[model samples]
Target: MTTRPPGAAAPATAPPTSGQTPEQAALRPGLKNRHLSMIAIGGVIGAGLFVGSASGIAAAGPGILLSYALVGALVVFVMRMLGEMAAANPSSGSFSAYADRALGRWAGFSIGWLYWFFWVVVLAVEATAGAKILEGWIPAVPQWGWALIVMLVLTITNLASVGSFGEFEFWFAGIKVVAITGFIVLGGLAIFGVLPGSDHAATGFDNLTSHGGFLPNGPGAILTGILLVVFSFMGSEIVTLAAGESPNARQAVAKATRSVIWRVGVFYVGSILVVVSLLPWNDPSIAKKGSYVAALDSIGIPHAGQIMNFIVLTAVLSCLNSGLYTASRMAFSLGQRGDAPRSLVRTNSRGVPQPAILASVAFGFIAVGFNYLWPDTVFQFLLNSSGAVALFVWLVICFSQLRMRGIILRENPEKLVVRMWLFPYLTWATIGMISFVLLYMLTDDSKGGGRVQVLLSVLVAALVVAISLVRERIRRNATQDALASR
Candidate 1:
């Protein structure tokens, strides 16, 4: 594979020639630098961070900050490896394409389909979450109606053009960033006894140690906290896929990789710190009202719950918008490489992958139907089946980077604009850490059926891998037969 320098224009594909089909047309570089920047920033902030941190804080107490840090570090390392490869060769496939070249066709096919499955499930999950909020606000519409409306709006945005998706995500992510930043600032002032009308007794750093110390449930709780908060970091890798469409794919990817550390530290660890420091970790309100909302209420903020709901709603929409885009792009990439139906590679006059987007949203709509029709049995199974896919994707990146490093260096060392820290050693360490997290998930069942999620996710992954291997064997046999006929 040839490599381009950082900030260089992406490699161009041949324009449609006479009698050539539009299916052979290339994806347009419609995403701007600002779009890419916000995508990278907003990718780290998920709806889970807004709604999910409460359980983690309850489990790990103030030590939940440590849990965030551990997971943050893992993400930073994984992003670095991904950045190194993506910078060298920008593709919408992102890590999946790298896995194909570095690992094997089977590895890429398995992980690509698994990742796609994960995001389409996420589409249903986010649509439902957003619909609930909308329903509460306007009791006129049923929850399923709201779900259909939310999915339809974003699906239209994605179908319009990549730029439209970026525009929507830009504002959705912007709201989340501003809300989190404001929360941190106000919570910090209250913790220091500076915010007026704040409850001095409740808003102080003493909350961290006053009640059972930081690790209230012993050190073991930190691992449990890891299980709770780890998935909140899932969206951080979306930027790499988005970067592939930017004008300067290499620079866009490298910049996002470099800044991931601070993004995690400030948005995740820093915000959680403000939460734990503002109120006692064991405070029932924290668990009941969520970490951020409870923190705002302690500082005498009026309508704290409503305010947080709005922010969480924005986060949900952002995740939904990006989920559709990411899933479709992965499918598009897979199609380009012959893993998926060639129909998915066909782009419209505006350069949008129409078929791919429709295909992804079609399944998303089905999942939404299952969510309403069988919330307990069918939807629960779908959720569990895709639960551990985030870790699986990260593990694949680590392994792909291990082999891709040599390929990049041998071909063009200068293309290594974003290098992984410590090379093979750090890469291997990341692999071990992710594997450990997956294994740890097996023994823990107290939090949201951890073991069952892992087991079911493993079952799904094994089935995908089996299909990939079978397909590869058939393709190889066909090639041999064609050669024999020649």
Candidate 2:
């Protein structure tokens, strides 16, 4: 069952076999366009949007918009490249498979395992954050208990079926879209002095200019903002991973890629613009309370702050679910490609990869246990280890696209349903840009804490690469021995 990596032509378009299970049957050539559409919308707008932006705004002040732009543009390029390969041959592995096909087994194995590691860490982080919020509302229950409950609930939902996962994501993304759109619309009205009880004080576009004229942190700050925001958009590409299980994968990838940038731009930059405009960059609330909630309160909206908390909670759960799914599929993909244990590839009757799911969840359970036992040590370790994979993932996407574009055009030119514009020119420029960011993180004062994450993630990436090289050597020797026996 080892299919050629994407960009190779499907072998003569042979008809699919008969007597397949319902999942094997309904698993359409393209994923359900609806499922992918929501995932694309929701994935980028997850916990990062709700929680991470607070720190970015605090670091860069009113000028965080520039940070969102820089990172947003990078994501546009990454997703375009990913879309090109996913459209050619839709697979649950997404970029991991692309790396294997375009690069080599070592590349695929390293990237797949690294990505799996990324999501499992996120699962623990999100559930921990979510549990903290739950404990706020219900002091009777400890945070550990809340974390367990949240994990079990999502685990059941994910194990139900692809359709159930799709349904949950649909509503999850739906709420995010509504919240952002409302923020933009409502915040826009307030900025123009439209709200009935609007204070209309020392705000009104002055914050952008008054505080060192939007570049208060200077041009250098823009790059710092990129470091903050780069992680925010990490989950957007999960849509392609889910595409392999649905009906119209090519179409979904195409539409999702094409529309992804503009959507992210509108939501991320737009919301930041509204927030900074509504409040002073140096406002006490900016540091004590988040920029977004503080701004909403400044505009005379009584409960807007708490209302946002609920939305943030939804965003956290959405990320938790997606992280579990992403890690599971990655492990499954690694197994299928002979990189991981064979048991990980085993699918339940519902087409769920049980071993992979459990393996991914295992870390969350352990991290939760640590939270119950020694909160400080385990929490910092999780934070430190979870830091830099976003950059790594983006770098791999850029490289995979470089190799994939050439192969797709050469092997099956017609299958380029969604082509990246400017070809090798923009693609090469993107590589350089990402390289600069990684180098810059080492010295950037603005990324004081973030540097730790970047460094740790680099260590993880290196370890994965080392393991991949060793594994490949062993595999090669086994292959040679088998051939010698014949």
Candidate 3:
């Protein structure tokens, strides 16, 4: 029923490099389509897939496969909607900007700050995770020391140039893609008794049914499994943000968006299928040894644990790399929009948002120190506090797309290069699904501390919303006062 107001201009189709106005061209076009493509392929494949799937398997048994499929479908739907908006209005702020245009300044300000909080928290969490791997490999440095080193390294990479961040992520994500693809190929061969000299004749589709049927923990566990794996899909939207820096942002976003659903669906569901297929869901080895390593060890892969550890290390670094980049770009966007300090909008000679990068990393370092000193008190609260923010971000995207679609249809239908399937119907379905997930989180208190996490996230979100409203009022008052004086 709603429509774009009269005189509202249709979204422009400016190539990032050839766009008019010196202000628009200030952001360098360092990222190529290949970088965007790789980033998309690799973004969904996180360290959590390798390390965290064990908990989901333990929770849901072989039925965990269904959980992954369900979550993958949800992500595909959400991304389709997000791509439709991002492809039309590419910006460093991404969904935040969309929320601003579609909803209001309040929605955009609250979601932007909350999203930035999520990634900054992620920076600390991932830094600690990478530190553990390094400390395990070479005990020369202590855990805290390793954490500091990893944070510093990635911070430098981001500050050096956006191109540096792109290059680093390209290789990091490449290893993950190759590793997962190899696992799927080799594991499938082993299941079919085609792998040479393999003891995998026992490994087949039977593993899925042999232990307590397909639903070992019953159908309810699938919901629990969803909570476990859903967070792993958080980084999938990084490609949309990276698209803003590309020479051809609209095409880049469209290409990345179109390819992401199939790639992520296959990579996540395919690899998980291989894992549960190779070993029984209740295999003792899976818990004692991590999921991927146990699956590799099942077929007698040499140094499986070491190889998996290296791969996980790469994933952690990739996440940290992209986390810093995403957080800073978001800060830069917020600064430009007046939600954050104006200094954050200033770029170095290389067109790098240095202040934004430093500010984001500074918070990350403080979090690292909290982990070292007061982990149980402060860091634990911080962890649980931001836990459900990914769901919140997804919810905002769903609503933003709903309003954005109406605007695009009325203003310029041609800008909708990537369309959400089924329009408003599926869009509403996705929104309902996300709301169900959040409510599910509130009631579920299995193992991952779901109830406490959701409660804390709610409190944090409320605080941010309040701050945004208060800031808006203050600005409104100031504007009125200025007009009265004039």
Candidate 4:
């Protein structure tokens, strides 16, 4: 563990490069404080919150608030643990790097690749989603053409420099934040019978009970709703990864960790509260128009669908942009640690990992091709195969933090800027909750294909772990042979 004196002045632009490997030193700290701030704020608001929450609302009724809260709490804990490690030692690899030192080489190798796989797959998903919206707006261009354009534009944004990625994300996330905040405010007004020209019949807290009543589908649906909504929280950890490129990495990480609770509460749970309050959970429009759009349309907002389409498009682009940046950085980190090809560590004069960026996007473009070529079979398999990765990632973070806490405390107590509350007990509880979620996923075949997703994800994770073990053994044998020669 590397430790700076308690009161030493922190670097203004990048993490200390002292004793850094060539690959680690190559990354530039071009992300400003404002960029990191918005990334942290925007990281909590994924497109899933806007487009995917309707089914959850339907499944749990108004009690879906509880589902979001439960998952939000889970994310809070995981980020806390991750923040502790990241604050102590900022790394582009983030949790994967912590896993390497705390668990073993295999732990880091498996999870890093798994996380990289998750994001590149996300690139295809977001690109296709954006393409659908673009095709709707401009009928002349084909969906595939829109996808190609979106990918190329963002790829260029990332390739230009890390600062450009941050600037793009800052505005993309800013638009989403403003849009959702506006929805919540307008919806809240209509619910209170204060908004003029509002004639929607279903409004107020009574909607929670007037219909089938909260939790009308029964208490089990809350768990079912968890399956629907958990993945929406996937990008919340992107801030920790982005922190590595910030000058004030440790302080930025600590602040982001502290703010996650409210961010999740206000953006996710708060927005859904307005949605359910503005209309009954079971309203036909809720399912047809989506939660946000339905709430806006209920209040007599014009062109609700198109308004949401624009917001969703912005979110998809933000996600695609962050997805490419994240996947490439993780690959660059993997290369630094010898878990990937040495070529991945190669950077251009601007300190951009061109090879890593190209490698990630190459896979993304291929995934987009699969989506078009085999929408039903191959693409569906790809989606399900990566579905449970978020849970897998949080689970690994819980385990890694359990070991990393002790390691940090022993090696350098001063570096513990962000501490996980209640130590081992809360960590253990988080582990239990995550494990239960995974186990529960195996039993349900709800809207998200929980059972199939979990089973396929497990199969894919096992394959990666197997590869990691084989690589470790081969490397171990090589080291032993060198010792014998010596």
lDDT scores of the candidates, listed in order? 0.89, 0.79, 0.88, 0.90
Q: What is the lDDT of residue 85 in candidate 2?
A: 88
**Cα TM-score per model:** 0.95, 0.92, 0.95, 0.95
Model 4 lDDT per residue over 1-486, tens place: 223467776544334653222224568878899999999999889999999999999889999999999999999999999999988888889989889888899999999999999999899999999999999999899999999999999999999999999999999999999998988888888888888788866456998888888889999999999988999999988988888777788889999999999999999999999998888888999999898888888889999999999999999999999999999999998998899998998878787889999999999999999999998899888899999999999999999999998998997799899999999999999999999999999898754488999999999999999999999999999999999999
lDDT of 3: 0.88
The residue-by-residue lDDT of candidate 3 on 20-119, one tens digit each, is: 1222344676887778889999999998999899999999998998899889989998899999998877788889988988999999989999999999
Question: Order of all candidates by lDDT, from best down to worst?
Answer: 4, 1, 3, 2
Best by lDDT: 4
Please provide, for model 1 over 165-250, each residue's C-alpha lDDT reduced to its tens digit, 9 standing for 90 to 100.
99999999899889989988888888888887776564467878889988999999999999999999998989888876676788
Q: Which ten residues in a row have the lowest lDDT in candidate 1?
A: 16-25
Instruction: Name the regions of candidate 4 deviating beyond 4 angstroms.
Output: 1-23, 200-202, 446-448
Q: Per-residue CA lDDT of candidate 2, range 397-452, in tens? A: 88888898888889879989988779888988888888888887777544336667
- Report lDDT (Cα) of residue 88, candidate 3: 75
Model 3: residues with Cα > 4 Å off, grouped in runs: 1-24, 446-448
* C-alpha RMSD between model 2 and the true structure: 3.5
**Cα RMSD to native, each candidate?**
3.6, 3.5, 3.2, 3.0
Which one wins by lDDT: 1 or 3?
Answer: 1
